[model samples]
Target: MDWLGLLAFGDTGWGDELLYGLGITLGLSLATFPIAILLSFLIHWAKASKHRPVRIAAHAYTTVFKTLPEILTLLILYYQSQAVVNWLTGWIVPGSSLSVSPFLAGLIALSLVISAYGSEVVRAALNAIGKGQTEAAQSLGLSPFNTFRKVILPQLWRHAIPGFGNLWVILLKDTSLVSIIALSDLVHVATLAINTTREPFFFYLVIGAIYIVLVVLSTRLQKTLEQRASKGITRMEVSDA
Candidate 1:
């Protein structure tokens, strides 16, 4: 009869259900970010290493991950997690139901997807560092680690923020795909609401509003971070003349 009635909690309404779904979506995004960053950094380094074979292997890693579609990964992980678990341990873990935890399955899927894309962003960022900077740091007798920490990483962020920021927004929207496996993110919650209340249009509209708000806020926050990262560089421009 009313919107709130439709969304109400405690088996009376669906509002609590939607909210819980949103929480899961947010958690999935956040949990993957750190892992993505770590993986990206390591793979980027391997790609950039002086050893030819190492670079080739890194290239293969990035290429494969980047090319593999996320849904494919999700299906594989969803079906295989139990097998993986069983293979690792001779005896079955008492409660490790791989197919049941859609949340974890979605995490693995989106993480692989975002991490592959993030690695490319990181690789380009590393490449943007001028050779002179590294050479100068070496001349100053700074260790490679210190040089990377102090000089290279800062500049790398400045160059990489544009791509990485865009990816963050893209991945935020992409989280909806997890609904297929039934982790019950915003899309699935809205779908349920519409079907239950016979207000398909209204529920969809509400879901759209939620998505718009989240994406807009995220975009603004990313812009602020990018501005901070590029503060020094933005003030000056290189003249090709």
Candidate 2:
């Protein structure tokens, strides 16, 4: 079959399978990003905590995740988490069997890895916002949470958008790693198609194009967000002049 025929949208072609795989890839990334952001905030808060132990623990978490290869993290989580889950299940219930799905394993592994880097991004953004804003809010009788929500958060995104945008692109590409664990992501689907059709170059090139397209779209969205985040500041500065 020609390349066009191979990619046709029907059972006779691998188009449907590839499209399904693309959905999984996108789904995994979208699910993992929010979890990573939440973890990043917690980790950043821990790092800034007054307690030494909390800071130390957060440091260790980031160090271990950042140092390890993402693929190794995925492998360990895929296999070891099942063992841990089974042990807990057996202890809780006399007879129970539980297994970790590749999707869950990948989600957790990717979240941890991304959050390690993301925490640093959060810290930097918070630092950029400066303590003066918080103090000013406090002077106005705003609660700490209210200060963060109203005063700090509005400015935080302007600084963080670029760093987190880069991480999002990285996370999108990293979704391909889950294919190794048989998660049936885009890359995995391409691999399966290649194996069946013996057209390695063509299938791999197609997936590469797909990844490039995703990255391009993500970058454009990031720029739009950055512009929106800066809009108020730009107007304020102009008014000051």
Candidate 3:
């Protein structure tokens, strides 16, 4: 087996296709993360809301998503979401065709699934900050929004980092599920390469290594951010002392 030629960067090998797939995988994960985090925060707030309906809805959202297998959720979103969109488009635009791309469907599915767990992470972090901090901020005449933006969020990251970091790694690996929908992400491309070259072990090993490298890199970045967030807290404490 001419390994070098097989893994070459151009049209001669699977390298370019693999790289393209890697790009898609990374892009999908990156795009999904912020949306997930935002939804997590929103859901957390809803869970804590005074309104009974809001809390029930938020609880149901978390319960359903967390209970469902991620792959099943992805499959449902990929097909059913398109059906919903088609129905809406048919009603609104008459003859126009509308469909959800695999990427979009994957994003929505991953975001919902991850956010269900992430909401709890957010709730925990907020609880760790305690009601005292909010009371203190309010006593100082800080508006609710300003109190959260200026006081709570800065410290929230300190507590939330580890949980969010774990979620990020989970999200990264979950990106592989998109391949099942023919998204042509890293795993899908690797499968394609294996089909043509008749080298399953080699392609799967390559993708595994790629995913491991990404996870390692993400872990290091998370550590760096954690240190930075903690340092800010340390400085504040020292100043108070």
Candidate 4:
């Protein structure tokens, strides 16, 4: 079969399998993103709290996750979480068996690492907001929640866009790690195809191309979001006149 024919969607080729694996890669990354964002915000809030213990606990959360290797964390969560869950289920309902789906385990593990890094970005964004902005909102009779939503979040997002863009690109590539647990993501299927066809060069090159395409598209989307967030904000450009 010719090189092109090998990528054909007909029964003679592996296109369908590759497409399905790509779908899983995209789905997993998208599903994990919002969870990571929420987790980061919660961690940042804890760190920002007036309570001393809350701040300490939040720091510890980021410290431990950020210090550990991501793959090791995933491996532990993938295997150990099931045992932990089954133990609880056994006590709650006799003979009940509980299992953590590989997808869920991967998502949780990725989110932990992502959120640990993301929390710093969020905290930095929060700190970038001027204290006078909050005071102004209060003087205008806006409640604390209203001040956060209206006066703070918009500016926070503007500062956060660049950091988040980097995180997202990293997250997309990181989804390939799920293949280690046999999730059949893009890299996994490409490896399977190579094994069957004995065309490792062609298949692996295809995998690299797919990743490049994803990152290129993501970068474009990130630029658009950055522009939208920066709308009406003025910057002083210094040039040799």
Q: Arrange candidates, best lDDT first.
A: 2, 3, 4, 1
The ten-residue window of minimal lDDT in model 4 covers 232-241
Model 2 residue runs over 4 Å out of place are none
* Candidates 1 and 2 compared by lDDT, better number: 2
Superposed model 1: Cα runs more than 4 Å off? 51-53, 91-100, 234-241
Give the Cα-based TM-score of candidate 3 against the true structure.
Answer: 0.97
Q: Taking the tens digit of each residue's C-alpha lDDT, what string does model 3 give over 1-241?
A: 9876888988889889999999999999999999999999999999999999999999999999999999999999899999999899989999776979999999999999999999999999999999999999999999999999999998899999999999999999999999999999999999999889999988888999999999999999999999998996788899999
Q: What are the lDDT scores of the predictions, listed in order?
A: 0.79, 0.96, 0.95, 0.91
Off by over 4 Å in 3: 236-241
Which 10 residues in a row give candidate 1 its minimum summed lDDT?
91-100
Model 2 RMSD in angstroms? 0.8
lDDT of 4 by residue, 1-241 (tens): 4878778896888899999999999999999999999999999999989999999999999999999988889999999999999999999999998989888999999999999999999988888887899999999999999999999998999999888889988999998888899998999999888888899899899989999999999999999998877765744223322
Comparison by TM-score, 1 against 3, better one:
3
| Candidate 4 runs further than 4 Å off | 235-241
TM-score of each: 0.86, 0.98, 0.97, 0.93
TM-score of 4: 0.93
